[model samples]
Target: MALRGTNQEFGRPYNRRIVLETIRLEAPIARGDIARQVGLTVQTVSTIIRELELQGFVMGVREAPKGRGLPRTNLTLNPEGGFAIGLHVTPIGVSAALVNLAGKIVGTRHHPMARVSPEATFPVFQALIAEMQALRPKGRMLGIGVAMPGPSDVDSMSFVGPTTLEGWKGVPVRDRLAEAHVLPVFAGAELGAVALGERLYGVGREFRSFYYIYFGVGLGGAAVQDGTVQRGAHGNAGEIGHLPLVPGGDPCPCGNRGCLERYVSRDALDRRLKAVDPNATIETALTDHAGVVDAWIDEAAPVLRSAIATIENLYDPETIVIGGLASDALLERLLAATEPLMHSVAERSGRTTPRLTLSSDGQDAVLRGAAALAISGALSPRFGLLFAGEEERAERDPIMTGPSRKEVAA
Candidate 1:
């Protein structure tokens, strides 16, 4: 269970988010079953369901299963209830999608981008927003979510690499986007967004906590703990690439030596392939130069294995996933090369999920995840948000509004 609900009236706001999350995950479910799963009373579920129905966020369907005792009213999230715009900012291009409350992408548009400054991106974002609004004319406009490469706001490694997004440190990204679009905006690293996307719509559906390693131009990582992305003090908790693993190893763009990513990332693989054939590219190199690929994998797999052991021992997540921009075959090769992993606490028996696995969300996972950010931020319950101003609560965190001042009578 990703989230659970409370029976107390004081916790009603959080309960609503929990109920909604459960319904979205296991739709066509009876309210009684929802209550049982979320640890809430049936009466509380009914009350929340009533409020949701009144707001058009949920709808009930009466169905009679064959040989059942009675016809049941099962609830499902209303797909048309609301829509959020998901924007994925990459150095090469921007991918935009219109995602609904049901977490489905109903429309999409893409624009090529050579630069990534606010002046360049906001205009493109405006065009895409117009297209998405035209595509779906009636739903509530929830807000916008953006996924971008990170290590932002801190001097230690702020936009320091070619693969990582540059010139983004101290940009106030979320605030700038909100001002540009005049909508609520939430932004985070691509890996965090992908983790959230997986939690909502991908292989992460069953696991409450997991670590995601993203292999794009460079390697990045993120963790979902207690059903939310664990953003650290600088919103860079999962910057696994920069971890110092190998002694006196290759220098990294982040101004560090022996960084894990220098040995195990796409750039590392490309450099190896280029050493053999100057014109080799990742796409054709896998087939045209199998030996080169194997050699690189053999060298990199040990580092990845060590990282996996560290992750398992430290986070103890249910599983660790390999994801992001690489082709499945390449990912499969890395997964295969890293076999017979080093012993760790996760080596314990009775675990249902394998310690190492690959994400099944496909190449567009980041874009889809970017879309999930808005939904997750607005719908996921945050207790501190209960104290936010009414305007902030309703605008930035709709479902997190605290209980009304009026009493709930017996």
Candidate 2:
């Protein structure tokens, strides 16, 4: 069903999210365009735009002259209007950044960890968050977004399982952060966050639906449809790493054999590199040991190609992007190695986007994605919040709270 909204923000946070998402995606746009895009009336869009302007979230700039009449004022987000804290956690370390409304990273702090246990990591997380909080202007701080590798709450895999960070199984990851932090806490799988970052600031800005493949210490993926990441039951919808591709070939922490990650992840690459030189890290291995990297690509291309074909057939995304931890050069080589991809649903005539693509944002995809996750929670509507008390809703999201003065007056 097409999503239409009441011409008011009285209690409809959904409308607010739609309008904000439309502006962010198609910025420098007039209110009429926003209304048409989001299926809201022009008057409703004008009212919401006025409220957004009043709240300092949006500003209007006169459009460039084209014809005789004066150009309409186009709305764009006010970068200084709000900020979000993004934290990306991995087995190696945790990093945090303060991202502005304009999707710019204003400040960042990264600290490595010998162990990723909660006891050892929380102090660093808190310290970095405190630093970010101190730096951000008051009242504009939205929330904290935590992006970590996960098959959270799954019976087959867990957050604390052999593949995941230790001591995080059954640890309400977001709840733990929310308890200690003043702002709301949002958490997501690292790959999902990466996809969100892509949607918000990268090539994904152009497509309403896209697929993302993450080649980090592990392999994972995410799907975005109609500008929103598809978070499946238990938020583990895109845990493609544990997919059994090579039956009975190798065991996985998720109690599976022949999992895809075993053959195609950073761990797989590092293992290959470490065999050649014990001290060889992924970066050094790429620069110094090109042959080994090429061989690994040759071996992984088929596994990844099959996975890509499966994703294409299932979701039929506008594009398939490969990123995360894998350097651009490596991704390019891998993409090249997977030449003449298998026939799938993506082979439709007149396709605008390529069947597969590579991203340059691999290095900071998680950190930036963590920031996007927080921003999403702050602005996106939640059906759970629909029935929750106003106080609870306000506590959850400070940005979209209560009704407009016009609604109360009416």
Candidate 3:
């Protein structure tokens, strides 16, 4: 006996997406289970599963025995169903990777940027994309996800910060890339991408909420709530580096005094090292100029703890993740130095999660996240449809014939 059709309000496309998301989150499960979890009829789920199978997004793995009934087919996502390219543009270089539907990095390439002008940078991006494409199996390239520095305008696809990439102000990066490659393009800030990547593929899969602190050339952060990165008024929500940590201390380029980045970022460490020994590199300073490193840690750790406590109070994330271009050894030392975390609401008893930890993805978090942005855009349900404009709603509305079980069943 077949079950009834889905309600009219939910629509067919929405129901299909619900089934797909259920399988993605919990795979190798029987079709009956999916129907139950998504609150859809068995016949409806079977139809959707058949369609997904034909489209190569899902496939039946094996038959699971049912008590006193026919064996049920268990389904799982097909990792090779689609692919996405993630490219990150930083002050020093550009990195690109091809990620499959399963969130695996199949190919990667990095190119140094001698100049940040559109003229010079476009070729580098083109070359990296070409290299990644060559490495992946020919399939549907969903889109390209670009991760750029913050203080950016997503609508304009332009960099706005005075200290960010030079000559990139008002540049139409997304449009230019889409035109050049003939593929859809998605753009996000560096920290936003990092947080999204973690949510999809890293420790984020384990926790529903957390704060990501990126330790790159400069400090930055992002807040993830239930697997979605929060993008505030502008596209620049996670500019934690510019947060005022010291009132009457060093002047920051952002016109702020004693900003967090001035004390805790890699650039800050370099500056301190240079002040101590004119010729010390980051590597040498860590090994040779131990006194400077210790001093910097002494000053930076307490402030970082304070910032973590502030994040706990404001955002109340389950855990705080520290990651970026900083070396593993440096990160370890920094995490160690920030020990005995300051008091916060998160310090309550019976807490299963630690207040702070290092990112499992390490330096590749942002690049991986750039790819995730594209993958998520393609597969995730469009909740924005509810708030879509009239034109958008009209364009996206699924065709609704007379609601007949047989018509939908077919």
Best candidate according to lDDT: 2
For each candidate, what TM-score against the reference?
Answer: 0.81, 0.85, 0.83
Per-residue lDDT tens digits of candidate 1, residues 60-100? 89896767487888999777676788888876568889987
User: Against the true structure, whose TM-score is highest?
Assistant: 2
State candidate 2's TM-score. 0.85
Worst 10 residues of 1 by lDDT: 401-410
Higher-ranked by TM-score: 2 or 3: 2
Q: Which stretches of candidate 3 lie over 4 Å from their true place?
A: 1-18, 36-41, 63-71, 153-163, 274-292, 383-410
Compared to the true structure, candidate 3 yields what TM-score?
0.83
Cα lDDT of model 2 by residue, 1-410, tens digit: 24355554454556766777677767888888888876788888888787777667778899789999998899888777778899988877888888888778888887878788988887888899998877754537778999988777665576534457867766777888889977778988897899999888777887889998888778889999998899887788888998898867777777788889988888888888889889888877777998999889888889888888889999999999888876787788888988889999899999778888776566777788898888877776564245234534543555654223333222
Report the Cα lDDT for residue 294, model 1: 84
